[model samples]
Target chain A: MMLKSKVSIVKGLSYQGGLPMLSWVLHRISGIGIILFVGMHVAASFFVHVVGTDSNIPDLLNVFYESWGFQLFIYFCAIFHALNGLRIIVLDLWPQALQYQREMTWLEWLIFIPIYGMGVFFILRNAFAGG
Target chain B: MSARSTLRPRSVQPAWSFEYIMWFFTRVSGLTMYLLALSGVVGAFILGARTQVDLQTLLRWMFFPNRFHVEPYLDDAAFWVTAWWQIMQILIVFFAVSHGFNGLRVVIEDYVGRSFWRPLLRSVVFLLWLAMLVIAVFVILQA
Candidate 1:
């Protein structure tokens, strides 16, 4: 059973979910992903680089780090998290921009695709070059 | 904590006074993170470019010498010589960590409801966040 209410304080807001809401959710997820990566990266670097922890663990992690596939996933998360963050900042700073949020989201995607594409291309080239 | 600042009505009032402030910070930090992350990601690739090794070769080299001999490459004097790079790295790391932890807090609050263990869980999460932040700072500076 579901209760109907005008106001609900779920996911930090009392509003109906929509495009902007979706953006917020994605932003949260991406931000958390980056944070998790930071933790993993730091721990791995510490043991391998500083303490010289002898184990195959760092090697296994390095495999993922050096993979083009993983790089692309990270790049995607980073690019969206950043540009969507910019959109959020604009909306917050200029209240009027709220009306144009849908447009802003579209514009964000427009900008993101090309940059992400170029990044992917660069990573791929580097991977295949065997340099 | 019970005196109302904005007058709409008690029934429709916010649950917590700090909610508004936290909401504002979430957005502000979002903006900061956007700038920091953009530069950091691009800067990382650019710095890597300087080394001129591709993915496969780099891996083989790293593992061949000593299996997974990964070390903090950022500690390279080349990176430290540039102050702006270090600053960017620090800011990016801090803002990203803060924003993410705060966000996770919000998620737990929303979903955990009025559970007896909420405070304990939240505290554990916060402590872990603090520890991670400290370790991250140490690792970055050591680099």
Candidate 2:
């Protein structure tokens, strides 16, 4: 059996925990996803730039970037990561605010939606505009 | 879930110094990532439009010198090489990678218990990070 740490974090696969916990998990998952993307991007650029090879690098990147699904996924990840990053900074700056972390999480979601919506709007507009 | 139990007490702290260092690093890196990402997004927006400055111009400056040897290319490349934005983007890549990987480390530590597999998993993660760092540095620096 796993030794339980004193922290009251929710465990188990159900992950039915509240928003803070959910935020924790999503933040981690999104962060990891972004890392994978970054790694791929760096590696691809390495070949195109460092090795000075064409090798369809531009084509691959354009295809990936132009795909709606990939774009939306990256959009979501970017929004969540950015907002969550601010929330973290706030909490860290005022540790007392940690008590209101749940409220902060809710506020983060509230802030994330419209900003994200605007971003998606532009992204979709650009996509459809064929520019 | 009262406030009292929420925090680890001063008495039973495990590896307090190490945790403090990691916590400090996270905050510092998180702030840096936020700034870099913001600038990067701004750079992207500037690139998307047909402005005086664009992403390809920055790329040609940062990465591609041999492929595009036109006058404008060299001129744009020269202007951008010293530009703060180009440097910010490069640093962003490095910080974003480190922040993401470190975030993964936190996740693994949180979810995976102190089992024999934990160390093994960490080693694998570390190796992956090392490989990424080497490639990332090469790509970022070797124009």
Point to the candidate with the largest lDDT: 2
Residue-level lDDT of model 1, residues A89-129, one tens digit each, is 78767656666779998899899989989888888888899
Q: List the residue pairs that clash in candidate 1.
A: A131-B54, B75-B143
- Backbone clashes in model 1: 2
CA RMSD for every model? Answer: 8.3, 5.8
Give chain B TM-scores in order: 0.60, 0.58
Tens digits of per-residue lDDT, candidate 1, B5-83, equal 2322334554566667778777877777555545644554565634644443343222111112222332343432355
Worst-scoring 10-residue span by lDDT in model 1 chain B: B61-70
Residues A12-131 of candidate 2 have per-residue lDDT tens digits of: 555567888888777877787677666666667677777767578755875785577676777688679878978988987777688889999999999999987976886677679885
Q: Residue-wise lDDT of candidate 2 within B16-105, one digit each (tens)?
A: 686577677778887886665555555444443245544434433232222222235343544434346436645755565666666777
Q: After superposition, how far is residue B30 of candidate 1 from its true place, in Å?
A: 2.9
